[model samples]
Target chain A: MSRARNIEALKNILIVVLFLTTILLLYFLWENVTMKTFRLSSILPAGSSHSLRAEDVTRPEEIVFSFGAGGVTADPDVDGRYWELWMNAFQKYCGRGELLAEEISRAQFLQLTDYRAVFCRFAYDLPLESFCQQRGISNRGLNQIACVTEMGYSAGSPESVFLYDGRSGRCYRLVSELPAEGFEEIIRAAEQGEYLVYYGAASLFGAESSAVLPLNYSSTLAETPCGAELGGADDAERKAIAEQFFGADFGFVRRIEESQGSLIYMYGYDQKTLTFAADGSMVYREALNGEAGARRDYFEALQDALDFIENYGGWREEQGRHLQLRVRDAYEIESDRQKGYRFVFGVGLEGVPLYGGDGNLLTVEIYGRQVTAYRRCLPDGDLEKWKEDREKEAFSVVGLLSEGYPAIYEALRGEAPPPVPPEGEEAPQEGAFEWVAARLQNARPGLVRDAEREGSLRPAWVLCVDDCDFFYDLYSGEAFGAVPRQKD
Target chain B: MKKVIMALVLVLTLLCGSCFVCAASDPAVTVVNPQGNSTVYADNILISVKVTATRVLKITVFEEKLLNEDGSLSSLDSLEALGQVTAGSLRHVVVSPAETFYSNGNLSFYTKELKGITPGIYKLRVTTLDENGRTQYLQECYVVVRPPSEAKALSFQSEQSGVLSFLQSFLKNIFGN
Candidate 1:
């Protein structure tokens, strides 16, 4: 009886163990399936990529306005004619051309006497007595003297006169210091229109305003020469526009008036800010707030932002404004923590884009259907005249490369020689370089003013190389300034 | 039958407890210390991250600039390359499961206070691949590295007070006045 009972008990135990094992197996299979489904649902959508339609679209032509030319004459002036004579005389004196053998032309002698400053190439051999007798000017025996500019001499002190030896092409400063009395006399003579000829090394070479010397120039000298104030919307006007455009629901708009002649508008709620400049440039920004439905598909987001910019962002059509903007670049961006799309509009006048002043003419940030930020810095001024003037002084690519490259290379490498392409690499031709539509011409044209004179505004061309912008004078082709890319 | 019933109940309980134990060992990634808004106030910032995975993990910290003067989302003035690795090479993958896999491991990053780093928002990311060929990235965490000058001032104040206290204690012990 005990053995039979024990055998039955063992069978019962075996059945219970099998039932538990089966249940565990079912649980494992169910867990695996559920986990797999969860993982798949999470991975598949993220793994698949979508294309942005804005990326496929071609960039539209930018409207470029012509900024007026500088103090260069269409026809050579008297100064220009003399500058040519000096160049010829120097070349002949240095034996690069047929030697004039120290002989002065009757016409050249008279022109020399009219110069407020006189620099003799070989001062010692100058036929000063005869020249002075003819001009009825009292004389000093002029000899192999250096750079002497009668007009620029007062500003460039008489002691600072540089003399270039024609044979060796070496420059030498004549006087360590000029007697204050003598310097004063020279200035008085210059002011009185009397020909003051100083025969030291100071007066050999005449400085041409438009001709830049071989490779000696500073890029820092070029500046937009404080732009003219084209009237801007005041605090009241800005406030009303901000309210009407961004919506009054942005709550309260506070104006932080310009400390440096620029204005800013700060909104209380939604953290929106708008900056308006005296030159009619405006920058607007706002927070994205929520992550939920605020996201839109890439192409949809671009279209929505485009619409917002056209309607509210100062890019709308207006008669006689001549101002237009087109999308130059659009891209889906994943930068730092912010993942969104950005559209850069090339601001143009008529059909040409005005290039200069902090790179982006106008940029719109679109996270989804929401336009999170808008920035426009289009210059507002006499657009028609500026455009017409720029057309006359438009820079050639060849001129920019020839005149601007040396200065740019020197600024980057210091004294080191610039790099040349390797043997098989296609050498960059003078005009072969690319033209990227740029904002902010790196350099502005400004007249070199004396203490009593206000300089004229000169038109400038900004040339970009390896992301560095070099501003060249439209008239002289001298690189007056350089600025690194904003992106850098 | 009575003994068999008792034995079955005991077996079932053991099996259920075993399942709980196995589930407890499932893979996870966790930041162990300085878990939230860690400030650098000393000679260095020490970050301890705990990770549980079936394979090697790629951990990197990146700095993000939140706003610019123009109020744009992207500022070119901000430095772009700020990624730092506390452990493992950029593309390192351990071959053997025995060496690579870990139930949990503490990886400490002693960043020497990240000198010369601009104070801003930063993020920590952990990523790994599972046996199912799925790439899994854990939730990114944000950390703010406070200005070093501010941290240094605080440290200097604390040190000054500590020195004064020590001096006062010494005086008391010597004179008892």
Candidate 2:
């Protein structure tokens, strides 16, 4: 009986041990499978122990500007003779040497009616305050300013100066005097108001007094001059024509009687019932006329001008020329679905003259609510020379300034000015390269020297040199040469 | 009888201990792709994988590799080996998931243009590890190449007079021209 009991006990112990072992094995197998399935590190390779150098990386900043031309006046006399004095003054003030003169003399300039200019300024590195101070300006609320100055020269009186602030959309008559203290005060006040002042008289940098005038003053004339030719015989006929052409909603707002026999009709349009001309060849103000609505629509007219100059190949060719004139027929209209007020002008290819000397005389017609100006060029004359000169002038003023200032060029190259030495202390003996190398070597031991001599190793060293003072020429026998001492 | 019992107990203990040792030796995890031979372009090729786990799975795309001279996987510090594309070259992609048990889920490789890839065989090796830090899996796959797509043929065909005539007639009918 004792022997039987011992055998039974051994069997039970064996069964228990086997059961425990099986359970443990199952747990281990579960763990192994779970771990194997979940593992992901194998997909990628090991990262390099090395760090990136400065020369191996670059950061770029891109800039874009949107602009529009507000109002344009086509002044035939806007030739080099009128701008020569101001151009000279600007070149002298800016210390631009003779380069401006050389460029301006060869530039092409055009005279067009209703020629408005819009300036967009983009700058880096220089603070806004410093930029304003340098331009003899002050800033108001907005980050940017637009100034327009128009000067009209008559046979007798001093040039009538008209300066308009884009921010306020108000015109200010500039007080003319030496030292121009009034102009300064106006600028200061405008700055305080955060106004963008527009000066149309001359280029922004030109002398404040000198201005460019429009060729045709008829548009600016207060009233129709007496003795001016009248297309229609009676007022009823004229009004009928205006109503028919300008849409039934159009009405005559005012009629000015001038000394000449000319008849002027100022027509108005309800915001809802206007149409823009198909081709954008005319000035914005003419297109707007009596149309009313949001100011942005007026600004769109300026944008259209910019678009025309930038996108239209023909207008660009005619810009800054005096002789061969191109005139556009003006049309006014409300925007598509009344997106505010919009206007446009159209000019035909046959209307533009190849040479300014062509004996063709131009005529401007106002039909219903529309106005079209036509001009003919004379064959064999100084118009071609005038166009070339005007173009050259325009290019010299705006083109160079837009490309990039000298400071911008330096910044683009990643060139920085040398650091100043500490006060009352001698400058360090080592150059930048040497100092950088020493600092790097101290920070990381033998990393600069131990990299491979070829291929991938070359870039690593180049990066080290860029970040540190050490110079490693991949070309010469000297692999890790220290920067040489500068000669006194 | 006492000696025999002692001997039996010792054998059971040894057997149990050996079982534990063997379980430990077996890989707990398996990796899916490594060497990034899963040919992909820079924009689209995403280095990722399917991780299986016996215990718990942890997978990651640790580093990226470019083709070496021997056509085997080699470490690349930069993408200079891809050479420049006239417009721009798209090559080399590296990505890693945040958590391990991708019980959280699987990762995919996204590439942009397959045409940019050179006509050559490529391999992708994936290394997988278990929660215990044991290497559980190393998986690799060979990728084949086909010729680049030809868009010029379509353009040429589009310029044919027959096509133009068909298009014009269709347009006229549609518009009642």
Candidate 3:
């Protein structure tokens, strides 16, 4: 009975072993047949290579206006003039009238006189005495000396007047010219100090000689002696002088209200005190050589100046706070010219901003199907105060949104939103992530396919996951939940 | 009589159990080159066979010869023990066909070089033994040696102007034009 039982046990053991071997073979066969098949046709295609479209992004809502004396010359008929016509045009185009034009021109003329004095000091290097004696002329009289100096000097010559100033140990030359009509008004507004406006060309030797004729506007200088001096004149007399010179053709939109978008005001200088009429036209009296003033215009230009003030000028009181906020765990996106840096606060579902980078508090009001961002500047000392301010503004919580979330979503899923439906029309059923994934899959099917196809082994797909998780899972095969939560 | 019957049955069972145990512990063997019917020269050729198992393995190469008219293996023997493969993780053996010779019906030659062997038919037998000193597997192959002159004639004919050259010229003309 014991031997029979042992034989039966051996048979049973062999049967069980055979069964286990069969199961193992079947599992291997199933894995080889089903999971290992290469699927090459599912790769997506490449996207279009095109320039960025401007209409897709938001633009600033305000305008900036400014006036300055230097830029490219647009007018061709200023009579061998170098800087006057350009300065005049800049002032005119920015809506400062003939008064500002007079101020800029006079200041430029004075600046040219300074140029001519430097030119005279260098004239000795060229044997000017021999040249003058040979030509029966003198460099003493203001008019005659200026004419001789103009003939002796060329723009490209290495001989420059400023170069001789230090060598000669003489005070710098000052040019005489008329001021703009309304100079006093602007000076009073600046409230800095009283300034002098010389009306005759003074040499490095401290001589007030009228011997040299003005290189530009010789006929005008001949008509008015001592040019247009404003010395010993009261404010009323200065105002009258501005009226006489400019003739009441002031051009400006009076009463610029705060509600007309944002206003950017700039202040600048001419040789004389600049005067402005009630209508914001500029004039100068007894103006110095160089024209100096701020220029402003709409949209991007104002934004640029404001951005400069915010970044480099240290004019904005809250700049430090803004900079701190911007540098904190935040990615800063600067403007194309590097003039402005915009901190992306948050993105909404459709890649639209819940609040702009301009520190505007956005409130969404929904009456029907329309959505509008009612923007207002944030209060002091609180960057996140916009959220509370927006909440108090009777805005509706139509959706949970952040300004930069759509970009984050695109980075994760590899696509962005599709075209929005027309008004009163229903949007498509595909969610943003699904749409992006489908687009990526369509572009290169190999990415979503079971196996890689020809020419489709690219590294773009690695961007879909957070960095910490990507490396963690690559080494340990265990997911590290998210990068943002890793430190915690 | 009943006692004798019981003893016979017990002996039969024990024999079957021993066979099962031996089979279970036997090594698995595999023969790699000179597969089935292959060609080989009469000079020395390396005959390699692999024997794998959970434990150690051993291999041996034997050249079998035919009988003489006296019904005995001739003194100029074709059959010989080429070499013994060591019992270890892996073993390889080189058989010298020059030391071996063909007998009445068998052709076997053992040497260290395969250069000067005539054309003939031969057999290679491989035997494997497990670490426990039990025969585990046996493999055999028949190899034919062709004369070197025939191989040279084949190579010369291949190089002569043939259809391959004609087709190559035709393609060059088609593509070049």
Candidate 4:
């Protein structure tokens, strides 16, 4: 009787297994019959990668508006609402531009961007070829300067367009016969928007200076929800990105877990090894296995890098934040694989740029015809919505330094303040602030992500002084931290 | 009752701050802060004024003492005027009494910064001159100062409808802000 009972149980288990197999088979058959174009391999990211245009990759870092006499304003919008409208309209005029001047006088260039003008600034030099392609203009003799660091259009002088090359500090001019009604409309809208137009840097110190001190101590700045981070992510949660990277090959990819919660995934014969570090950074390194296919120019190489970025993970636009890759720099580098260019990018939210601890969103190395390396360091989710908050006060360059004054004054001066009246005195004066402000190479507002805090981001003013980068809270004017300035 | 009255006055002042219009019609000069005899705790004050005189030629901005030492609020104005912010050329981020300021053409904006003042009621004066060298318009806003540590609230209460903004900035001041 016992044997019979055991046999019955075994028979029941087999029947259940058979039913499961049949259901799976039926589902597969149904899928095949209903969706002929669908295949398991089609789900791979490389098969239908994200597609983007050259114009989408290279964008201005800031849209600086000179309102009145030395009243410059950079308005940070929640969504990149109308920046593209201005940029696209500005590009339409560049196509018909005729070479006006190779080298514009310093006074002339400053005059163009000084008042009633719109200056589109790039964090790094924009390749002339890429810029031309982006605007759909022929590269032609536009190579007078290898790169365009900044460009502008003065409503006051609609007949002429200004181009700035940061490398040479030389300005170029382009003349167009087209009407500048588009730019005028954009400018009029921004002007009428009632932006907080502060006294410009030129008003505080001198012309063509980036250092700015608030002329009015009681003035206020706005605070925006910059960026966000994910916390308490488990190993499986972090490995999810690795799976997307491997795509069709994810099943076969060898995943090696490292100490301190690091994850490494090696794809087929060491072709590519991706690392997800504990610091929420992801790096993709392609092994130098294939033969040198073909050498290409920077433009073609950039396209390839963009293609790879889309295939693996898009600019996170699908997430609805309109996140785009704003290229900060392009450098000629030689790796063991081959000599190629490295494109460094910072993630841009709408039009505003959010810089990380290292201020790098992504770095891709294109060797010959292939992308040899790629690095990504951002919060877990690209399109994260920080809690909605109203605008807060922004810290001025002078105010920010004042928060850490005297303490940093000694470091800034490399000595104590001279004794006034009696001995044992180390009192800094306005002159000390003036001294530091003069040395400030540049100051701009953006969001800062603290790497150690797992993506805790805050709105801050990023300042470069004496080869160092300092971040101050946008509202409280408190110092977040400072790191060595990364030379482009 | 005294604390409640002070709170109520502060609330009213902040609500009406953005559109504070006191001067005459010709130039329409409006003061932004230190309304008459308002109390504040800050190291420096900005003589920000809005003028409607389109034909203004020159504008001179400065500050003057409104109260003598040993005044009621003067004792509370114990903050060191010559702060590092002035010394380092850095400006401190001071919460404005007004919640929201909309700019059209009447906004003259921030014109001058006055630093290193001893605690007392001080007057921020803006003298606007027309095409001629003569003074065309003048704006004066009086503010009382106290030590930063003596302040009771993170910021003044506003009647403006920006409740989210008020809560955001206030929470920022008290929290990990």
Candidate 5:
């Protein structure tokens, strides 16, 4: 009986062991499946708007822009006689067009209306609908031209400024926010009685005359005066156009103010802004509440954003003339239990991305499947005109590995300085091929400019080394700048 | 007869002691920093995990998609790849074998300075193994990543209890044994 009881006890232990072994085997299988699924999702797209397929991603084209034009670096040839007449007309409107000649010569005086009409002839190129005013700066009364071209003083594009030449007691104040490159050359030319007429693209280092038009004349010559022919839509028409762009026009009506030739329809109460130019260009901005709803999945938010842009952004899929907008990156925001995604879209001209000096472009914010904010500054120009065919020489990637990158890595690692050995010890040396295996991450073509200084947008090879950026200018073939990576 | 009874009592005592060890000394995995349901303010989060295993440890961070019944993660998707490190990379605590039972220790991972991490929920999954090719512990914790300015200081813990502890508590509750 004792032997039989022992056998029964041993059999019970065997059964328990088998049951536990099966459970353990099943647990492991489930664990592996869960891990595999996690890995697969990372490589896959987050969904429609937040995720991008390999084919859908745009590979930006690389191009280099030359700096100098006609052997002069960003300098324009000025037509002194036309400028003299234009300034005189401007001064006459300010009650001094003919009086300037008393300080110089009477034959040089020109009629204000005739000059305005002539300047308005290139209204498409410059802002010319400005009203003249006299303002005292530094105790000297100067002729102030508020809006001199097609640009608005407030926004849309970078403020396009015409050269301001004002007289302060026998001294001339050549006022320019963007002083052209080779200002010394311009001053020497002006002293010789030759005026420089600047025309073409803005330079990185202020104004360099790309084309020169010398006015070889002794006096301010006045010809036939052309009439001001620009016209704009009424309040109702403006409201209708704004509604078409915004899809939902719900803001309180406010006064329409005209500045720098462009009519801006300001919608108060909600801070919605709508700007329009009778020349068929416009800019619109709207703000929405971002903290009130459950968030949508990635694709849903992306589709909503793209649909909003296509309907109201004045950018059409078929119209190749508008700036081609592409997704630069997407950031997910979770704060205060409020979740959202901010998508930054880059403006591409032809195949090259256009970098605004202010890092300005289109940015859309989506919260809870709805777009909460939209902001963009679409400049009006033929984008194709700026496209370059020949790629210029840029600093080689191999060179970046050895030269600019080592310093950046040292800063990240916090390597200690070598201890001094005796009074005149030699410093320790790094291995010849030390950084050879240090790979660069997230390399791509980006349009970047110096935010602190005035500069034109240029193509740069933006790469991540220790999560910080190293911008290599394609034109200058040098290390442009480094931006420390923003922390979460 | 008295000797036989004594031998029987000794064998029974040995069996009960072995059962106690089986019930109490199992491995456990847990997230230390950014406790479950807590909001992470810093962009580069310092991730710390505690493990009680003798062999290799694999820690993974996944952008969680769904929530399970116990208010934990049900599914996961990878957003960024933070490569693997050794389980013993960082020494955490010094406890005796009798007190810890398993190799109770901690491992920390520092994330790269990420640019625009969408504010959302994420899951950190940790798996550990024993020396004899046996699974030790597998557990996950959920966290919220957000900007510092918008974060709320609220913390709650929801971890998978060790199997031995669960059984102990269950027996104590049911039988008061």
Candidate 6:
């Protein structure tokens, strides 16, 4: 009887050992510890081709360095390393910082950024969580905030960073425990640097002046010259870009020239198409024939877009002009009942925008981590002269609109929206500059293709009155072009 | 007591007459743009000024050609005229706050554009007086200018908050509350 019992116990021990071994194997697979060899599929785009990170494409539309007392360095890129240095430092210091005010009133928001600080304004709103993740910032209640349109660090409150939500009009502050070395470096640069200074509209106009947002802007813009950056791109370059899309299967792709002078390269049963237009624009589109897939987050969609652009032709500056793209707009797009996102990027030289065309340099649509559409309209610009001492003339927003109102009024059909008077005040007299003074919804200085002067790029003050955009000569304040605001 | 009261009334009237001769700081007149000492990023500068004055005012911008040909200081006293603004026609209203007091007041807005200027520190002095011909004083402020932004279509940001108040209003012509 004892021998029989011993045999049974041995069997039970073996069974326990086998159960433990099974669990260990399942754990390794679940954690992807052993699947690391297969993880390349997840990181790389389809067909094991292409490389890009979110940081490569994400950039602030413009950076403003406030030196207190209404002194600001907007577009603080004078061919200096300030833009990159400030961007890196702000991210490094504010990541994982504590939240001081989860949300602040508009009054406090304005006050926080009004003083000595470096603020980055984005053309497109960033999902704060995705932003924090991309910047590698983890904790301190940053997740509570939904979106961040602008981020800045105030010298007055050195311990904190302020975030403004342009959409919700909400403000939040994230505090840092350790001293911000990056912020200090920027402060040192602003104090000791020979940067350009612009007065805020608030400083020039009354607080009630609704001329410009953030009220921290100069009405005038520096004038620079630009010519075609990619006007000389030949068929060889276009073919090379197309090859990047089809990879080693270029010979297998069917090429067709459209009646509109655009050459289309179709890959296998219309799975994808690449078009090279006579105007030197290239577009790559994917057929979205699959069923609606689960929508991915904005970060994933953005990453896919970045990877797609990087793989096709490239996103870096073409020619010597540093043609980088910055996010201008993002929206939920649907096709055939399939949900996805469309990201529009404004092309610029050395991080500044190129203001003509469809107002977008690149547009990409992504669904379920797959990019379905990509468009690249590289500027045909010669920016070498602009790289020189570019500030020639400037006109204040009032100056631009004062002389520009008649044309502006006529261009926009004499219905330019006037600034609403403060409550308890009578409406402004229907005549006089009441039509334009301090009523500018926006005033931006940027590079535009001079329609009058062919093959030349001239600086302009792109003023937005109501939803209509009026491009005026930065020096003369003469109307350049006007168009209705493109809906996001 | 009656004689003393009569003498005080006579003194008050005299003081009131003196005040009208010069509006002084009350109902102040201030310069709006090119806040003094401010720097310009561009080689060309426009001495733009936005002034909202209660009385008729003269806006003059003097470019202190502080820099010589060698780019050194030129004794800071040379006031080279950059631009000036004077309106020929302006509307005004007569207001009576206390009995027997009628003042011609106007809330007029004036702005002047600056001319071509290179990178240099300019001490611009602005002199203005109401119809009373009040004496002027000096106030310091700074403002700067930079290149045009017509490069790329900029993403628009049209709402922020409070503005920098009346850029360096050298003399405040406080008309009303």
Please tell me which predicted candidate would have the highest TM-score against the true structure. 6
Candidate topping DockQ: 6
Clash number for model 5?
29
Candidate 3 TM-score, C-alpha based: 0.17
lDDT of 3 by residue, A1-488 (tens): 99999999999999999999998778557433233222211111211211111111111110000011110011111121222222232222223211110011222223333211211211111222333333333322111111111111111111211111211222212111222222222212222332211112121111222112111110000000110112223444433333332333322212122353322121233222334322122222322222222222112222332332222112222334322111001111222222212211111211111211112221211111111111122222223321212211111100101112245455465677554444335444554422322222000000110011211111111112221111111111221222221111
TM-score of chain A of each: 0.42, 0.19, 0.15, 0.72, 0.38, 0.70
- Model 6 in CAPRI terms: which quality? incorrect
- Number of the candidate with higher DockQ, 4 or 6: 6
Off by over 4 Å in 1: A1-57, A60-230, A268-270, A292-299, A335-338, A387-396, A406-460, A467-469, A480-488, B1-177
Model 2 C-alpha lDDT per residue in residues A1-488, reported as the tens digit of each score:
99999999999999999999998788557433333222122122222111211111110011011011212222111122223332232223323211100000101111111122211111111222233333433322212213322221111111112223322333322212212112222222223332222222222211121222211111110111111012223544343333333443354445444455443445543322211111111111234334433333222333333232222112222333322222211122343333331222211112121211111122222222223222211121122211112211111211121121222223323574344343334444542322322222111011121112311111011211211223222222133433211100
Q: For candidate 5, lDDT tens digit of each residue in A1-488? A: 99999999999999999999988778446433333222232333323232322113221121111111111111111222333333443332333211110011111111111111122111011111212212211211222222222110100011111222111212111222232232223223333442222211111101111111111111111111111111234555555556454434435455466666666655665566666654334555555555448876554565567665554443433545544555555556664577877666655644444544333456677777556566554443322333255554554433343345445556555663332233233322332212312323334445554443333345665655544566766444377676543321
Which candidate leads the pack in lDDT? 4
Q: What is the lDDT, from 0 to 100, of the residue A365 in candidate 6?
A: 84
lDDT, model 6, position A2: 100
Residues A1-488, model 6: lDDT tens digits: 99999999999999999999989787565533443222333335653543455665566666677655444556625354666786677667755544333455655555544556787776657877776666676644454456787887776566667788765667766555556668757756766866555544444544323233322233323444443334465555555556667777887999898798778899988888987766555778888867537778787788777776655655444335466556667767787777888887766665445665334457788888667877776565435566444334465555555455656666555565554344335555453344444445556776766645653556667776655667877666667677553432
Error at A15, model 6, angstroms: 60
True contacts kept of each: 0.00, 0.00, 0.00, 0.01, 0.00, 0.09
TM-score of each: 0.33, 0.17, 0.17, 0.58, 0.31, 0.59
Instruction: By TM-score, rank the candidates, best first.
Output: 6, 4, 1, 5, 2, 3
Go through the candidates in order and give each one's C-alpha lDDT.
0.38, 0.26, 0.25, 0.56, 0.38, 0.54
- TM-score of only chain B in every candidate structure: 0.41, 0.28, 0.42, 0.43, 0.40, 0.37
Q: Interface Cα RMSD for candidate 3?
A: 47.2
**TM-score, model 1, chain B versus true chain B:** 0.41
List clash counts for every candidate, in order: 33, 122, 63, 9, 29, 48
Docking class of 4: incorrect
